[model samples]
Target chain A: MQQDAARLKVTREGDIVQVEFTSRKILDEGNIAEIGDQLSVLVEAEHRPRLIISFAGVDHLSSAALGTLITINNKVKNRDGQLRLCNISPQIYEVFLITKLNTLFHIYPTVKEALESLRSGSQAGRLK
Target chain B: MKHLKLQAGPRGQRQSREKSVGLWCTEEFPSEMSEGRRVEEKILSQCRKHAYGQRDLFALKLALEEAISNAIRHGNKCTPGKNVRVKYRITRQRVDVMVEDEGHGFDPAVLPDPTADENLQRTCGRGVLLMRAYMNNVVFSPAGNSVTLTKFNESSSSSDTPLSTTTVAFG
Candidate 1:
């Protein structure tokens, strides 16, 4: 069994950076770290810290993937930017619950809501 | 066999042992990867009920999945002609898992670090690192075709345990 087909994309809008992960399963090891570290390097080098993750394409995630997301969250936070997630599949939502990462990161039902939250600082979750 | 006793939580104080429970299975290569992960989780949860939570169950499960994935992918190379073997062992103090492949083994030392600058964005190479991190010990055979992993049933060897098992919204 090959648990190895996932694609990642990074884009930025104003101060907010959007990261899109498209895969059937992101549970494979080093997958999260590899993608998360790439995003961190971008933030560190380009100074575009704000990040929004779209999980619409992901159906499965594991502890390692959760760890990677946490690392990305922390990286953006340290740089005075925020990491937000949107459009998580219900199955993957169960993954967040199982791993209890759902409590640590901010997840929205839609991309628009996540973007709006970044524009308004009233939300308590953003790192900045 | 000299029974080695260990605790799972803060100290041995919270430990409880089960008398006898054994479950094992094996299959050929190219089977669904998600099914393998689900099997691992089920085994660990059942073991946890008999014993206490090691807090490392999640990590161990992930490690086991990586090892098996490697065996079926790199070892068997996803060739339908080849087979990957999976074995499960549970004792009072720990749980052991072995994933073996039919291919000629590769060198572990030569394996590139997945965290390296050049390899950071790659999807592979993190399996070994994760296997080592999640389990107490990760061992490979002389041929490197097989990897063995053992996870202690206790949490005191290190301070890491299961954290909030909570929800976070994005917007």
Candidate 2:
């Protein structure tokens, strides 16, 4: 796929895949669907996908986006994979908290921290 | 001029406050996410004109997008040729928005709480929950084809429950 058409910037490091959002707002239904598909493909390709999705530069997101994240989490779990999320803005973090989704997803403050947890198998997540 | 009333005030319970002049707009768009974006931008532009803070804008943006998308997907079944109608009024204190779809309405009362442990992992069903959380008032029409959302600018989140379930006028 062309770089401009890609909704995520994905790279692999050993068993870990670091993903970054290309769109600031993950609210658009089309974009959310595409993001879900892309992530699904990546997760399915691995025996046990270790993925970290960074929310850096994301401004606004809707519940639809949250639903997409939930879908990704389920897929990773079904395959016995690990998923970590990091770099969430305060406003966006509040969305997760309001819906009580902060408990469901492994969220961290920085990509380094998320990468560490994915590697250490001691993932702890909460909004600070 | 269309007029609508809410049983509960911005601060929750029915209270009397000085009414202020407001700017209002009513529009219709095709059942497409792009059209939904147009509606969102139009409304957010209005909110910005009235000096709505970033926090208020974020809440409104989230609620409006969810409401519009629900109407398009769930209500219209993602079929083309159908339309979503939006009407909102912005005042100094608050903004009230209504979204209606052409499809038959369903009861809004039976929606499962997405926060439940079992439902937490569900891929859908969180739209209405977020709308209720961010907006001070969220009401459905008697027929359930429409939703009315209200948010008070620069106001803290409300602890008041909805005055009445499915209590909005949609014509």
Candidate 3:
């Protein structure tokens, strides 16, 4: 499944859906709603999905953004799917650590690594 | 009306002179998401001009955004006629921010821990956590209608003294 929104661009890579945010700042409330709506469409689909969110462009993230990620992660899990995050900057990564969200989501250093792990069907080292 | 101003002498004065600029502003914004974003951008630009490091800037911006959004959304309940008041001060050594909403406050002690196992997958409770983690001091008014956040500049003086402190009146 593929989807596009104002700030989020979703594309399929094999069985894994890659969702990339186009905005540098993902803290706005409108952006949060748009992301949630788009991701919800993916999770509620008929097939179980494996997803990766690329944060290459996101430099600033707020609690709203983190909340959206948690909500999406739950929806994905409810459908027996998986979610991973990649390409996060150090500053954004610190926020995830501070909130202990790094424990909840599987984070990879790069999109390539995330895709490889998903393709290989190995869940090791994805969540640490 | 920017919230900060800096003044310094010529570079070749041969004697180092300390420049201090203090600014404070109080503005009432409609209880809307867009208004909160605007306030965040204004505050962030001021922080950048004051030479805050990238990590510090990111933390301040994120914390400020969370506080403003909380006031507009939860505190005011997005009421059209309601307004949120924001007061911020920026100086050479630190940044202080306060946000107040025209709504009945809740007890801060009752908030859930977002990092808890059962709550980790939840969405709504992380705002308060982020605010506390990023800001050096996060204090709420007795009624909980207002919050004050302080971040000390690491580049500022080495003394442990805080640049400024304000006491919020409790109801």
DockQ of 1: 0.08
lDDT of 2 at A89: 90
Cα lDDT tens digits for candidate 2, B1-171: 444665555554344133434556899988898889888898899889877889999889989989999999999988899999999988656789999999999887898888888889888888998899999899999999999999877742343222332245656
Q: What's model 3's lDDT at A65?
A: 77
Query: Candidates' lDDT values, in order?
Result: 0.64, 0.82, 0.79
Candidate 3: residue A31 lDDT (0-100): 79
Q: Which candidate number maximizes DockQ? A: 2
**TM-score, structure 3 vs. true:** 0.84
- What is the C-alpha lDDT profile of model 1 across A50-83, one tens digit per residue? 7778887665555457657666676767777777
Q: After superposition, how far is residue A92 of candidate 1 from its true place, in Å?
A: 14
Off by more than 4 A, model 2: A1-5, A124-128, B1-19, B155-171
Give the TM-score (vs. native) of candidate 1: 0.51
Q: How do these models rank on lDDT, best leading?
A: 2, 3, 1
Greater-lDDT candidate between 1 and 2: 2
TM-score of 2: 0.84
Question: lDDT per residue, candidate 3, A92-128, as tens digits?
Answer: 8888888888998889988888998888877656645
True contacts kept of each: 0.03, 0.85, 0.87
Query: What lDDT score goes with residue B63 in model 1?
Result: 75
Q: Candidate 3 DockQ category?
A: medium
lDDT of 3: 0.79
